[model samples]
Target: MENCKQEFEEVDVVFSKTKHLTKEECTKLQLQDSRLVSEFQASKLEIDAKKNWDLFYKRNETRFFKDRRWTTREFKELVNGGKSCSGKVLMEIGCGVGNLIFPLLEEEPNIFVHACDLSPRAIEFVKNHPSFSSDKINAFVCDITTDEITRQLELSCVDVVTLIFVLSAIHPQKFAICLENIYKLLKPGGIVLFRDYGLYDMAQLRFKAGHKISENFYMRQDGTRSYYFSIEFLRDLFTGAGFNIICNDYVHRRTINKKENLDVPRIFVQGKFQKPS
Candidate 1:
């Protein structure tokens, strides 16, 4: 067991060192490191990533997501006498570290949230968090694909379900399955708001030519997986899963700091779908 642990630590170190590689350095590492190449080849990296995500939140939840201090201004505006959230339930599918969960709670004190994720570590982190509360924010460890969370728990259907930076991590084919399940739990006229990576973001372009795992999906050196998505596919998935499209917008943003050009590319695709009231 000790030998196995040492070997695992060695592999982890290699993965960490490879993360900051320049696009050129990335190519060289891919070429020179046969182990890394084989790890990429096996395609079991996604399963390996479940552990990686566990380690990630365990080690860096506070520094990485900074969930404790996050608040969404738009959510604040919307809920503080805004049109949508006066007397509605809200759910965030992958409420990692409770960034969106706690913020949305702070925004509209009256609304309740049923937040879930597949990672038990993530759920535990949220549950034990200083600001966490069972009444305002109910965090659960659940894999929506296999788990009958909504029915088993007897939590009522939600008014709006938020999927923030989450759909990009799932197997692309399972996207529909996820959407269908969420739709089943939403009241008529409920919305699914998504904020995630768009195509050609920095993460997508990091792929070595051989690292491609079927279209826009790729495995990073750290065993974490990512998928880049487009607006058209997102719209189709929601509509096919029994949602009527109300609003779909693509937003482009930039940062302004003197002497530095920060053209960080992001796609904000907001969708408001109703179940035919």
Candidate 2:
């Protein structure tokens, strides 16, 4: 029957309303009454973005974000879509403390990696990491929105580019420029693997109106910023950047920590886009 088929049909994500952390104080405030960040403060946050992220690593080096071992599984393109991975060039944008970089090397040792971040401290952490090697990785400091990665890397040389949880920190208006830079670094047929916050994610919903910098973008308490993306927006972004979208969809998962008594739903949009061969 139609009803039975619908019930048992495979689904990519089970849609749910945005959730709230049960004990978060922000939930108590009404959006209308809460104040948005002032223009001066917003500008200061943007200007001081690097300093804030550096301080973030200074305060919690190699502790804030854990090793992302799930990257390979989530983005098959990282491992060459099950093909040979030998001699491939991988560039991880916003590679904080080499968390993802080191683990990726351990899992697939044949590929070379170029890891860069806006925070010099973060890049230092990567260079100082025991697994880091000049032969294996070239870690550097770069603010992709303004800096030219081509100076360090030959244009169109990279086979895969990973933008994981990085773009959300940048101003939305600069997204096109940022993607353009990334596009120039990839081989003609190379792919970009992207995963970032999704619109109405719990983290987005957790912010009080006072933290808002713009629609769907907010300033965190620590001075860093976050922007949530809709699937439609991502499609438009990548396609408009001249990429052929392989897949783009919302991924929903829950972060569970029994010791902390935490179970929070998280939403993210992930996609793979390739340049024309």
Candidate 3:
């Protein structure tokens, strides 16, 4: 339950739901819907703050990911795939306080990661981390829709676009632009690896009526927000932007409070979107 709250505060994304992918009609519908998109007209997009990300991490840091509950084993599989990241330049969108970045370095220490976040505080913490490497991990402040970071990462020349938990925060209208920017940054055939909240997880049901910011989008009392997604919407968004959807699936999760006999539902979507060769 609190995973929802922590999810928002950590990097501000999540709203889970999904039907069985095997359902024939549902699968067909998801494949054909192009105009489908969520509305987040009321959400905020700016992350103006001081250069230092210390206070930001201090307030939101958690050992949760240290348990590896959220990421599963997909990271290692791709990182060590037939294609290697040994000399590749990678860019991570919505990279919070180095939670995902530092561990990635541990996997392939020679590879460099160009990462950004809207929050200055988030960037600050990542820049100042103990494993922080000017050569391997370049942390910076950026907003995907408005910032010019492509030139800063020119030396690295991005080969991969990592979108872990990033898309849901963006206002709907800007999503296309976000994809466009990623495409521009990436080398041809570059892979965009991503994972985020799904459609009808318990978190979405927890929202009271007034919290709804738009269809399938909601804001908590905290500044954090979330958007539930249908698989079709994601396919259309990336496919229309010229990326091929290689893998997309819904994962159902259940959390148990053994002592209290409580079982909670959670859902997540994971995908590999690839630019054409």
Best prediction by lDDT: 2
User: What local distance difference test score does each model get?
Assistant: 0.63, 0.85, 0.67
TM-score of each: 0.76, 0.87, 0.76
Model 2 C-alpha lDDT per residue in residues 141-233, reported as the tens digit of each score: 998997478777889989999999999999999999999999999999999999899877877777866898887789998999999998889
Off by over 4 Å in 3: 1-17, 20-58, 61-72, 76-78, 82-84, 257-259
User: How many steric clashes does model 1 contain?
Assistant: 0
lDDT of 3 by residue, 84-116 (tens): 657778788888877777876776676778889
Give the best candidate by TM-score. Answer: 2
TM-score of 1: 0.76
- Candidate 3 Cα RMSD after full superposition onto the native fold (Å): 8.0
By the TM-score metric, which is better: model 2 or model 3? 2
How displaced is residue 220 in candidate 3, in Å?
1.6
Instruction: Please estimate how well model 1 matches the true structure, expressed as its whole-model Cα lDDT.
Output: 0.63
For candidate 2, what is the lDDT? 0.85
Local error of candidate 1 at residue 122 (angstroms) = 1.2
